[model samples]
Target: MRILLVEDNQALAEGLSTILRGSGYAVDAVADGASAEAVAAAEAYDLVILDLNLPEMDGLDVLRAMRARANKAAVMILTARGTPEERVKGLDLGADDYMIKPFDISEFEARIRVLLRRQAGLRSSIVNYGGVTFDLNSRTFSSQGVTLDLPAREVALLELLFLRAGKVVSKDAIMASLTGFDDDLSANAIEQYVSRLRRRLAPHGLTVKTARGIGYYLETTAPTA
Candidate 1:
């Protein structure tokens, strides 16, 4: 999934970004609330990890502004304050979950999973489509009881397509989610990856259809076994 992390702590942000990416998530991180607000407003993010203390604008203000604009992206507050008042305030301000600092990485990821699941209206961690089963926690794909190994970027791409199956996902959108706003990838990079993905899924009776003059779509048809 695509995530926006709004944190001023450089060390923590880098660490979390690495971990989340390794866990098959596309993460874009900013060190201030204003940048966070801008990125969140402009991009399509599956979730947002917001810090309460920020430069330019406080995280609460950012959340309030996002909600005011009817940005329905799921938000989780990351703060040092673990007090009841702080938690209540964040929730009241529209934060979905709150996590205090010095938290366990596994627990943090678990909370993120919960928020994403809730957003997708999913009750289970495993997402099934056609004959394919995707293990969100393991980042593994299995079809017809055969496991398919996919690299991290490919896995993230597949997850994005599956989450919005049948919708046209633009090349720019895919690039932004995978490479972040600061990185530069070649224009043909997404096409190359999509081509590779289509080859891989061909055996499974699924395909990534390119919408000429548009982008790509994932469709389920009879397996070509």
Candidate 2:
């Protein structure tokens, strides 16, 4: 998953980013609300971890601005404010989830998983379709009783494809979501990754269909006799 972390606390931001990266997510973190709002508007993220108390612009203002611009990415408020009114205000501003400060890391991670799954129209941890299964929590991909040995990039790529299964995923979006904010992975590199991932899925009754001048989509198939 690609996440934008908006936290002003340097120590907390570093710790959270490290933990998020360790869990196989591509994260772009910013310190202040202005930077967070700017980045969120300019790019696409699967999730946004926002802090309410912010500099330049208040966190609620940031949320309102994103929603005003119709940015529908899942947002979870991570703030020190632990009040019902604050929680309600965040929700009303289009936050998908709320987490009070001094939170359990495990619980926060679980909430993130839930939001991602919910966004993908999934109601469970495992997404089973077309002879493939993805364990969201474990970040594992398995098929036909065998888990495909895939690199982290390929794993992230496959997850995105599965999330948008039948939809046409533009190459630009794929590149942005799979690579980090500072990554210089070229368009050619993305194509190479897609090619390799295609080969791996082919034997398992799945196909990555290319859309010329566009991107790719996943379709299921059974091996022919």
Candidate 3:
């Protein structure tokens, strides 16, 4: 999953980014509301962590603008603004969830999982596909009750494919989901990652098929026609 973090505090932003990335999410963070708005509008993300207090633009205005532009990424307001009126206004302006500052990391991560699951229209945190089961909370993959040991990048790639199960995911989209803004990955590298993932899933009868010049997709079943 990809996330855009908009927070003015450098320490907090870095800490949150580390935690998110450690959990297999590609995160891009901006310390100001203006940058956040620009970045949010330009890129695609599974979620946006927005702080109401921002420089250059108010967090609420950023949220308003994103909604105006039809950016459908789920937005979670994380700030010191704990008043009931503020929360209502943020929700009224299109914030998906509101979280107060001085929060527990566990609760914050749980809320994130909920928002992401809700956005994807999934009722459970465990996703099963083609004999492989993925635990969204633990970021682990298991097949027939046996855990699959895989590298972090491979795990992230597999999660992306599993989430989009029956659809063709473009290489560009894959690149975006696997990398942060400052990271650069060549097409060759993407192919290498996919190839590795393919080998790992082969035992489970899960195949990653290329769409020729486009990208790749996980084939749950072979075509009979």
lDDT of 1 by residue, 1-225 (tens): 778999999999999999988887778999998898888888888799999889999999999999998899899999987899989989998999999987998899899988988887788988888778887767788898888888887888888788778899887777766776666677687788788888889888778998897888899977775
Clashes in model 2: which pairs? none
Candidate 2 lDDT at 126 equals: 88
For candidate 3, the lDDT comes to: 0.91
Candidate rank order under TM-score = 3, 2, 1
**lDDT tens digits, residue span 70-188, model 2:** 99899999999989999999999999999998999999989999998898888889888688899999889998778889998888888988988888899988888887787788888
| Model 3 regions more than 4 Å off | 221-225
Q: Supply the TM-score for candidate 3.
A: 0.96
Q: Give lDDT tens digits, candidate 3, residues 20-73.
A: 988888999998989998998789999999999999999999999999999999
TM-score of 2: 0.93
Off by over 4 Å in 1: none
Candidate 2 vs 3: which has more TM-score: 3
TM-score per model over all chains? 0.91, 0.93, 0.96
Q: In model 2, which range of ten residues has the least summed lDDT?
A: 216-225
